[model samples]
Target: MVEKESSRHPEVALSLPFTGLWLARNSPARRVPSHGTDLFGERYAIDFVGVDERRRTAGHRDWRTFLATEPADRFFAYGRPILAPADGTVVEVHDGEIDHAGRRSQLALVPYMLGQAARVRQGVRAVAGNYLVIALPGGAFVALVHLRAGSVRVSPGEVVTAGQHVAACGNSGNSTQPHLHMQVMETRDFSVARGVPMAFRHFRERPRGARQFHTREYGVPAEGAVVEPLPLPGAHSTS
Candidate 1:
C-alpha cells in the first residue's frame, strides 16, 4: 500500500507522537488491547496499547502497570506530545482525572478488573480517559484519546495548525497500557461517533517482522502493524 502525500508544509512537520525506539505498525494480525465494539458485534479489536518500540525497555515488568506509576525521566511515558494531525480548532478537551495503575500487578489488576464496566458506563470522562478532539478544516474531526491528566496544552475554541502538539499520550479511561488511540470521526460526540479509516501522508511504514522500511506517499497501517515517521526528502512527497 502507498501513503498519501502532503504537498503543503512538508518540512517543519510535527515530530512523531513518540521518540526513541520504533514501534509495531498497524495490522490485523497483531494482538494489542482494544476498547469499543466492532462490526461483527465483537466488543473490541486489538488497539494500540502497552509501550511502542521506543519505550519497550523501561524496566517495567508489565506494560499496563508501567502507565500507572511514575517511571524513568521520560515525559512522554505518561505525557507524550499529541500533535494535531491536521490544522483545526479544539472542539473538545477532556481532562482532570487521575490515571489508573498498570494491570500487570495483582494488586492493580484486581480492582480494575472488577470495576471496569462501572467505569465505562460513567461516560466520556470515565471511558475516554483524558482526551482531545480537533475539528479539521476539511469537515473531519480527529480524536486523540488516553491523554495524560492535566497535560492538554490546547483549549476549546483554540485554533491549531496541523502537526502542532496538543497533549501527551497516557494510560487512562479504558486503557490497559500506555499508547495513543487516534481515530477520525464525523461527529463531535464520541458516544455516537463512528470511526473513519485514515491514512497518513509521507509517513514511513515498516511492516512488522520486516527488515527494511518502505516509503509511501500515503497508506494505512494494519491493525497490528508497526510504523515510524520518516524524515523528508528521502521520505516520499504527495503529488
Candidate 2:
C-alpha cells in the first residue's frame, strides 16, 4: 500500500496504554489510513497484540488454532489491564457487549471477514464493542476499543490520569482475537470524527526477531515491532 501524505492535523502525544510486551500492527508510522480505510475514524488507528517474553501470542497452540475458535482467555492479551494513555475526562463509555471467542483458523476467519460489512452497518456498538472515549485538553479525543465485558471501571465525565487502569483487553466486536485497538480522533463521535495522528511517549521497541530494544522518546512504533513502555522510576510493570 502506498504511504499517505502527511496529515494537516497536528500529532497528539500519548503514553502507551499498557505495560508488558506487545506486538504492534497496522501502525500509522508505516502508512496513513493505517487500517486501510478512513471509516469510523480509523485512518490512524493501530492494534497491539499482547505477547510473552518469547513473543508468543498464546501459551499453547492446539487443533483449535488451525481448525476452530479458541477460548478468549487463552490469549495473552485477554484480561490484561487497559490504561488511560493521557490525562483526560471520560466523555463516553460502553460496556454492554459480550466478550467473544477468539479465532486463529483461516476457516474461522474467512466467515468473520465476510461479515465485516454487516458489522460496520450495525453502528459503533458492533464495531467498537466495549469502549471508552477520553476528551484530551486540546480538542482531541482518544478512543480505546474492543475492551473486555464488565471490566470498565470509570464512567463518563470522570477524570483519569495517564496510566490509570480503565478496562481490560478482550475479543469483542469485530476483533478476531484479544487485543487493544486505539486511535485519536477529532471528535468523540467516531461516526463523524476524523482521525488524528498520534505518537507514544517513552516506549522501548524491539524489531521482530531481534533481541535488543531501542528507546523512542516520542514516536509511533514501527509495524510488526514488539514494544513496551519504558520503566518509570517508581512504577512497577504489570503483566
Candidate 3:
C-alpha cells in the first residue's frame, strides 16, 4: 500500500479516470438526465466520456449504437487508471462484482431495460460492481463506481490525492457496457448520499457543434459527450 499522504500537493492535477482516449463525456449517448433514479430529478454536471484519438462519435445517436454492439475487450478500459479526483481518505471500498457481458443489441437491452426495477432491487450487491468511497479533506465524499474487479489498489483508511492511480474502470455494476460512473456526495453512505454537481478545473470544453476546444477553468461536460483530459494548459478538442 502506498502510505505517502498526498493532500499537500495542490499543484498536481490528476488525470481523469480513463487515460488513453475518452469515448464519452459525463452523460450517456442521448444527453439524458443522469441520476441513479429518473424520478429523483438530480442532474449530472460533468461528462464521463473522455475523448482521445480512438473516438469516432459524431453525435449521441452514433454513440448509442456503439455502446450496445462493441465487444467488451475491444472497448477495453481494463488497465485504465482510476484516479483520485480530490485529496482524501478511503472511507469505504467495495469489490468482487463480476463484469457483465456487453449488451449492444437494443433487443437485448430492451429486456434488461424492462427489468430495471428488478436489477435495482438486487441492490448494491447486484450493481455498483467494484467501488470506492473517498472522504475529501474538505468533508466532501466522492464515489467511483463500476470499477474493474480485483483492480482496487487502495484499502480503507488509506490516503490519496487528486489524480493518484487508485483503480481501473471496468464493466461492472449495473453497466450494460464498460464505463465509469462518478459523482460527489455530501456523505459517504451512498444509498442516502445526494448527488452533488461537480466540475473539472483548468480543463478544455467544446460546445456541441463547435469545431474547437476552449480552455475552461471550471466546466461540466454534458452526458454522452466525448472530451480529452489535457494538462494544465488544456488542449484542442478532437470533437
Candidate 4:
C-alpha cells in the first residue's frame, strides 16, 4: 500500500553512500515520488548504478544484453562497497535473499516487471532483498537496499560513522540490475513508513554526455548525472 506524504517533510543531509563514479537514476531532482510510487517509503528514493569512466554499466555486452539475463557480477556496481551515509546505529538488517542475475534485455525485464506486485506482496525481504536500516540521531531512518548476499558487515545495534562500509551492491529483490537503492524514512518499519526528503552533502557530478564536472555542496543529483564523493581531507589515494 502507498502512503501519502505530508504537506512538508524536512530534508535530511547525507553523504554519498559509495565511492567512485555512479549514475543517479530515479532522482527526486527529476520528480517527486521519485520511483513513481510512495510504496515502501520510496517517494524520495534514488538509485545509483556504478559506471566506468566512459559511463558503461558493464565492461562488455553480449547476447544476454538483448535476449536474456546476465550474471549480476557482470555489472560494474556489483560487489562495490556500500557506505554509511551518516552517523547512525544499525537498527535492522536482512541478509537472507539470494543475489539474483541481472536483467538488461526488455524481453527478460517484461516478465520481471509483471512480477512486481507479487514481490511486494511477499513483503520487505522480497522487495528490498538484503538491506540495512540505520537510525539517525534525530529520528529519521535511512535504508540501503538490494545489498550483495553475504556482504552485510554490521549487526543491529552497532554504531556506525559516515563513510563506513556496511555492505556491497547487488542485484536482488525487485531490481533489474546491480545497483544501490537508497531512501530516508519516518520510521524503522518500512512496511508502514513514510518517505522523508534527503540530500547528499559533498559530491562532484557530471551530467550525462557532459564534458566537465560540477561540485555540489549539498543537494540531490539530477537524474542520469554521474556522481562521486569529493575526496575527504587528507585521505590517501585508493582505487
The clash numbers for all candidates, in the given order, read 24, 0, 16, 0
Cα lDDT, all candidates: 0.57, 0.91, 0.61, 0.90
Write candidate 2's Cα lDDT for 1-239 as tens digits: 12224555678888899989999999987988899999999999999999998888999899999999999999999999998998899999999899989999998899999999999999999999999999999788999999999999999999998889999998789899999999998889989988988888889999877889999887899999999998555654332
Per-residue C-alpha lDDT of model 1 across residues 130-192, encoded as one tens digit per residue: 888887665656777778888888889999776567787777787655667666565678777
By lDDT, rank the candidates, best first. Answer: 2, 4, 3, 1
Residue pairs in candidate 2 whose N, alpha carbon or C atoms collide under 3 angstroms = none
By TM-score, how accurate is candidate 1? 0.71
Regarding lDDT, does 1 or 2 come out ahead?
Answer: 2
Tell me how far the alpha carbon of residue 107 in candidate 1 is from the true structure, in angstroms, after superposition. Answer: 7.5
Give the distance in Å from residue 164's predicted Cα in candidate 1 to where it truly belongs: 1.0
**TM-score of each candidate structure, all chains considered together:** 0.71, 0.94, 0.75, 0.94
- Model 2 RMSD, rounded to 1 decimal: 3.2
- After superposition, the stretches of candidate 3 with alpha carbons farther than 4 Å from their true spots are 1-15, 23-33, 36-47, 50-54, 57-71, 233-239
- Name the lDDT of candidate 1: 0.57
lDDT of 3 by residue, 1-239 (tens): 11113222122223354445454444522433455352211234233543344353212334536445444544545446778776789999998988776666686688778877886787765657788988876566778888888989899999886667888877887777667777666677766655554556655555566667666665556544456556644332210
- CA shift of 236, model 3, Å: 21
* TM-score for predicted model 3 compared with the true structure: 0.75
Ten consecutive residues with minimal summed lDDT in candidate 4?
A: 1-10
